[model samples]
Target: MFDVLQVGQQHGTSTDRSRIGAEPVLLSLSPTIVGSRGGAMVTMRSGQAAQAALREEHWQEMERFGDFLTDEDLAALPQTIRDGLIGVRRPGGMRYPAFQIVNWGDGTKEVPPAWLQLVELLAPAGWNDEFLILWTSAPNAYLEGASPAQTIQSFPTEVTAELRYAAERAIPTRPGGPGSWQ
Candidate 1:
């Protein structure tokens, strides 16, 4: 068993330009760790694995999302809920990936159900938000050219299959899975 903890600073940093702080997100992985890419593999203890993973990637905050969303728009959403959006506490502020908030082009915005299921599945495992965002944003062979988030909005069946694959890969109990520290 592993314990994961994440606490954000009360304020944001000058670089990130928002109210997010350095989140020492604690992730507990199994004896064997999976690299950020789904198929790559590594062997390390949980703590070392977590630190190494954090060092491997950088996170961008909500402010960087450009026209997709504004501070006012994010404020309108419920901050405490994981729901469909994934928020990471960064030195600059609470940032979300641009893909999480889809612009319908008709002025209606909605979170895809598949996206929400993936977030809910991985969050409790202490999966870093960076990893989560990367997985969703990265290209997958199963979804053709679209990332998971995009597929979630455009193809319902593809999204469900993708989410199932992600969950299987992220948890260690399932063999050949993408193993997390926990």
Candidate 2:
């Protein structure tokens, strides 16, 4: 059995521009292993083992994104270009999602026109990098089950509308009246 622990602020680093003054929240996995040898045998994973497993899992997830640029890789690019893309900070380093950029294969990367608008729409929300990555990758109801990352390029207008609606909902409002708390 594995239990997840939400660890707050493992490192004081964030790649997401919108998440100023905020650090990435890390999830640690703690697992208890059970075996049967004509009976029941139980073993507990040490802290270091759990951490190593978590790091491995993070790398596996990163690989699923296909090709990504690290923080060091992005440092070679212009600041404006770096600011236009979204990056998530993981155990080892920051990873910029490749879907937002067009790799020219000559060590050059360009942000698509629609990505600029998408980043702008997401900036004011102050969303952390983890949430930003998950939101973009996950199937959205507003998109009729299409992921934002998948449709943002082809359906920029629709993606923009969905982002606007999501941003509006993210704002906390006093439903009762001024000075009222929910």
Candidate 3:
């Protein structure tokens, strides 16, 4: 029951530019146990445990997959989507390691291998937390050639329209793709 949000101005003139606002991305995610490589546990203080469990289940599915997609599929993404996802990282402001997860679909075609693989790679295990949900929607800030813009380097700023726009744009929506999850 959480929505991701981001804050930062679009920098540069397109080519040699970048977004240098916050880091670590304070995820407004659902509460769940984060398993680390060493099996340490940390929980979110302001989120739902059940929802976090569900999200973990989704991520686990990705971990179970090995090369579920092909190079062709990754390359096929709209250039914007590809660029956006290819080099994404957690926002720097975060106190601990975290990622803004996205809800795409339950299939290979609908979800990319890199993204699928990333969810697993980034979500190694150890840290955990309770997530917070908002009544408003997120943004659509899809990257240049990566996965749809679902996750955002977020902070506690009271989810605003501007934040939603950034998220939506970050997430590259395929012309006739699935809508946002409640």
- Could you tell me every candidate's TM-score relative to the true structure? 0.48, 0.49, 0.21
Question: What is the overall TM-score of model 1 with all chains considered together?
Answer: 0.48
Q: After superposition, how far is residue 128 of candidate 1 from its true place, in Å?
A: 3.6
After superposition, candidate 2 runs with Cα above 4 Å error: 1-62, 65-67, 75-80, 103-109, 155-163, 166-182
lDDT of each: 0.57, 0.63, 0.34
Residue 52 of model 3, lDDT score: 63
Rank order (by TM-score, best first): 2, 1, 3
Across residues 13-62, which tens digit of lDDT does each residue of candidate 2 receive?
A: 34678887787744335434444435866455666457656655655775
Cα miss at 38, model 1 (Å)? Answer: 30
* Winning candidate number (TM-score): 2
Candidate maximizing lDDT: 2
Which has the better lDDT: candidate 1, or candidate 3?
Answer: 1
Q: For candidate 1, what's the RMSD?
A: 16.4
What is the clash tally of candidate 2? 0
Q: Every model's Cα RMSD, please?
A: 16.4, 16.2, 20.7
